[model samples]
Structures are given as structure tokens and as C-alpha cells.
Target: MTTGPGAGTTVELVKLTKAYGATVAVNAIDLRIAAGSYCCLLGPSGCGKTSTLRMIAGHEDVSTGDLLIGDRVVNDEPPAARGTAMMFQSYALFPHLDCVDNVAFSLKMKGVPVEERRRKAREMLDLVDMGKYAARLPAQLSGGQQQRVALARALITRPGVLLLDEPLSALDPFLRDRMREELKRLHRELGITFIHVTHSQTEAMALADLVVVMNQGRIEQAGPPRELFNRPHTAFVARFIGGHNVIRSADGLRAVRADRVQLGGGDLRTDGTVRALEYHGTSVHLSLDVAGADDFAVIVDEARFYDAPLAIGAPVQIGWNHADAHPLAS
Candidate 1:
């Protein structure tokens, strides 16, 4: 009741464990990603997120585990054997080929005729809104455009499973935002399985039906972005997702959502001195010093702060309902 998104897909990982001699990259784990769902493997670098993704894509051999794509186990399948396509962090487009040719390269290998491949390639490009740029080479296109070409190329195969490894990490913030929208729209239009891997909490939050949190070759949690952000199970998630004040008390665990907490609402009722404030256009990040409490930083909307009592060096009361304080994995 405290944490979970309404279930969407049915992806299952049964006793999946990947190891390299003394090092275990992915521990024995079980997970389910529903079909036609957008799931993200979120974790810091070297936390087995990429390992987990490669295992699913058949790029990395599973040490000892079963991978299920929908209902079938594909543990021994090759990358080409599985109905999956991977869009790597590097665009990996052919520089000599135009956008359309790059998108249709896989189709050519599949033995489709040139006309059919070109047609399908153009269709996929149009889906990503890159049809007009089909005549341009990789050099003529921007980073984001090149990414779109990669996405189109991946989709041209009509892959039942799409594996994207930090596909948008190369783009600027503005382009990333736009591509997020494009990805969301494209997912609905295609209705295929999308498994994305990234460390950016913002990317995971903005685009995911299921968000799998991983650390140290293990899964920390898996659920929707809203559930993970609003009710993180551990301090790591709270800290990793940013704009959270994690505090431990005899009462229980507490984390103040920057967007949910009221700033200095009850003056002198709580024990916190405003140490610093950063104004970010429409919202403010408040750094509070609480005695007997760890630094409880919060994010509050500037518009809502009109009724808030926030002053530098002022003692203020900070409060949140007990219902919001939920248990998490230690």
C-alpha cells in the first residue's frame, strides 16, 4: 500500500544471477516486466544495471538464470535469435549511409528487398518524425537526430523487445526532454516492450511504466516512477532521486518530498534553522539545519511559499503527516 505503481506489464526474471569468477554482477533476482511496458533499470555506474540489460538483450551470457520474454525462457538464445533490438549508447549509425539506409540496414540483412526495406525505413523514420531528414547523412544531422535514426533503425525490425542503453544520455537537456516525449508517444503507437537502462533519475522518472532500482548487483526496488519518487523504499533511492530530506527517528522513517513539503509552516514548532536557499525560477531548494536531526533539505514551489515562513537563519517548524513516512529496505 505504501509503495507500488499500478502493475502494467508481465516481465519476469527467475533466479537470474550473472557472475564472473569472484565477482557477481547480478545476484539471484526475480522480476517481471509486463508486455508493452516501458521499464527502466536505474542504478549508479557498475551496479549491474547495464549487466542486467545486456543479459536481457542476450548480449551478455547469463551465468545462471532464466530470462523470460513474455512467457518463453530465452536463456541460451543469441542476440539475433531473440526478437529484440538494442540501441546502444553510441548511435552506431553508418556514417556513409543516409538516415533511411541506416534505419533499414537490419532489414537488408533479413533479406528484404531494397524497395521494401526503404519503404519500411521511411515509415519508421516518420514514426520518429525524422522522415524529412531521411536524405541526410549522420554528419548532417544533430546528436538528437542521429539518436532518432538509431531508434528508427531499431524499430524497423519490428522487434518485440527494445533494449535501449543510455540512448538519450548523449543529448542536451532540451533535446532529452523532447526525446522523452517522442519515446512516450512512440511506445504507445508501437505497443512493444521497451526496456531502458540509465542512471539519471530524471530520465527514469519522466519515462517509465516500471522503474527497477538496482545497486551492488541487486535490485533495490521495482515499480512506477511516481511510486519510486513519492515513496522510495530506502535512503539510497531518496538520496539518488534528489530533492529529498531523509531523516531517521524513533517514530519511523521520514523523507520530505521537495514538491510536497511546506516551508516554515509552523514557526518555532519544529527545530530547523534555514541555512541556505537556492531560487530556481519557480521553485526553491531549502537547506535546513535541524538539531538532533540530519540536514533536512526540502524543495518548495515559489508560488506556494507566499504563505511560508522562510528566512535565512530563522528557526522554523517542519512538519509532515505520519502517513507519508513509510518503511524502506534498510
Candidate 2:
């Protein structure tokens, strides 16, 4: 991959840490994000995902360790000097300024001519599909439109890396999904590294090429979403990433995808009482209470499940193949 200015740059954190006196926000962590890759720092609040992203954006001080963008160490550099742009969860568009002006604010700070900056701003708005709203203020536009303007503002700088701190958390579910596609398309077109910090596992699974799962200020696991979902390294990862049922088997702790757990098939068998059944449009989620396991779940196809539906508290037999079980660390 190419390195340096204007190109997607490799981001490396060597034992990076952040602390507030005795309290450590981010434990010493090592991560190397490939150039032009979409990487997501995923974890619940207080897991230090935001702190790590802020440190990379040069918005926060690194308590210790090296912060490298491309081949250059950028620990002490200012935010603007780090070749990174940050988009906050709030979108932070200038309410008073029109969309075009909001996007051109960065260039205006650099003393660019009004006509030239506005022209550049319009181009950015066009890229984000917000050109038609360029003349409107933040209040006049919708939530998604405001977000697009914010994105255009961040991109106007043409940085090597884009650091987003929960960019879609503020949008409605439908808008969030639409914006996700927009973000992915933008990343492909721009070919720049995108380091997004989000707590939503669904978002990470949908968007990230690499997902870094953090817990208690440290990385629990880091890999492709499928690897983390299919083969979790630890119990925390299995539970945090969702969709899987972690259980203590005779052999050891293992995790099976809810979809993989069969209601009444395969050689391996176990008996459980139907604790709850949820009817989703495409699939049915069944919560079961096995003899030894806590709350086991199986995702059944909507049509198949309805064909022979079981009632709550109904005794049911469940089975899964040995190959479907993925062992987990305690």
C-alpha cells in the first residue's frame, strides 16, 4: 500500500495509553491499521475506543507510546498537523452558516479566497450528495442532510485519515443505514483510511474491514468481523459481539451461533424448555432454558418455525453438530 500525504496512510499505535492521574482510560495497546482500510474501534462506553481514536486524531494527548501515521511519528503534533480530520457524533455543523459556508469554514481559516473556497465547498457537497442543500442552514435541513454537510466539511481538508467518533449514533435507524452505505461508498471513492469508533456491533459487522473489540481499556480481540463472530478468542468477545450462545460444555466453554443451533436435528442432542419466542419478520428467535445452560437461543427460519411452532414453556429437543461448536477461552 502507498504511504504519505494525500494517500491512505497506515496508522500504528505502539503501546499507546491514556490516563487521568491514577485512572487509566486506555491501557497500553498496540494496533496497526493498514492503509486504505476501514477499521472500527468497537466496544461499549468507557472501553476507551473514543480515547484511542482521539489520540490518533491528535485531539487528545498520548499518555505514553508512539502514534505513527504512515512512517512519521505524530505524538506531539496538533490536530491539523496530523493529516487527519475528525467528525464528532453531534455532526457539529455551524448552525448560523449555510451548508456551503459550513463546509468552506476550514478553507476560510486558511485565508482562501471566498469564490475559490465556495467552489471547493460545492464540490465537497456534491460528493456527499448534499449539493442541493448547500444554500440551506442546518435548521432547514434534515438530520441526515446535516450529517452529510458535516462529512463534506471534514473531507474538504482532504486528509489521509478520517477519524469518526460515533458518526451515525445520532441518526434514526433508517437514516443510519442509508448513511452507512454513503460512508462505505465515500471510503471506496476517496480510498482513504477510515478509523471509526462505534459501540454498535451491527455497524461494525456491516462496515469494518477490521474490527478491534475493546473492553476495560484493553483489546479483547482484533480481526475481521467474521473471524471475531465465528471464532471468538475469549468469552467476552463471544458475548459482546452477540448472535452467539456461549455455554459450558463437558469439554470446555464453547460458543455456537444462534442460527446454527438446530431445534430438533443433528446427532448431538439436549432438552430445553422454550422460555421465549420472538417473531422477527425474516426469522424467529427462540430463547430456551436447557438443564445446565442458562438462556440458550436458536434462530429458526420464519417459514420453518411457523410450520411447527412451539409455545412458551413447551419442552423441546435441541441439537447441533460438533463442527458447529467454536471453543472459547474462559
Rate residue 133 of model 1 by lDDT.
99
List the global CA lDDT of all models.
Answer: 0.82, 0.92
Which run of 10 residues does model 1 get worst, by summed lDDT? 1-10
TM-score of 1: 0.89
Runs of candidate 2 exceeding 4 Å displacement: 1-6
lDDT of 2 by residue, 1-330 (tens): 223333798899999999989999999999999999999999999999999999998888999999999899999999988888999888888889999999999899999999999999999999898888889999999888988999999989888899999999989999999999999998988889999999999999999999999998999999999899989999889889998888888988989889998888966789999999999999999999987677798999999999998999999999989998888878
Candidate 2: lDDT of 279? Answer: 95
Residue 215, model 1: lDDT of 90
Write down the TM-score of every candidate.
Answer: 0.89, 0.95
Residues 273-308, model 1: lDDT tens digits? 889988888878888898655777767777876565
For TM-score, the strongest prediction is 2
Error of 1 at 23 (Å): 1.6
Scored by lDDT, the top model is 2
lDDT, model 2, position 141:
90
